[model samples]
Target: MLGIAAAVLFFIAFLINAADITTNDVFSSVNVMLIGLGLLALHVAGIGHGRRTGRR
Candidate 1:
């Protein structure tokens, strides 16, 4: 869920920045993408842990 949220945030941010007609802030998009990827990594780690412990 958190990963999904992050991805959504990144997508929205990308759309907003892309649609703007002013100076492009590369940091914003990069930050959002990083955050999304971080969340995804966390989720994957959690899943791996759960599987290793045999927890459903």
Candidate 2:
């Protein structure tokens, strides 16, 4: 799930960068890309992987 989120964020950042969008400092393409990287790192660290509950 986090990988998916990172991919989406990366795509958004790519779109923003490719389109040359003008936005606030917080939501800039670089920031989005950084956030995506952070998520990817967390995913790699196995932080958010929930255990599955087997059905009875």
Model 1, C-alpha of 36: deviation from truth (Å): 0.6
lDDT per prediction?
0.67, 0.94
Candidate 1 residue spans exceeding 4 A from truth: 20-27, 47-56
In the range 1-56, model 2's lDDT, one tens digit per residue, is 88999999999999999999998999999999999999999999987777755697
User: On residues 1-56, what C-alpha lDDT tens digit does candidate 1 reach at each position?
Assistant: 66577679678668757876343566566666777788778877674243355568
Candidate 2: stretches off by over 4 Å: 52-56
List TM-score per model, in order: 0.54, 0.86
Q: Candidate 1, after superposition: displacement of residue 53 in Å? A: 8.4
> For model 2, what is the error of residue 14's alpha carbon versus the real structure, in angstroms, after optimal superposition?
0.3
Worst 10 residues of 1 by lDDT: 46-55
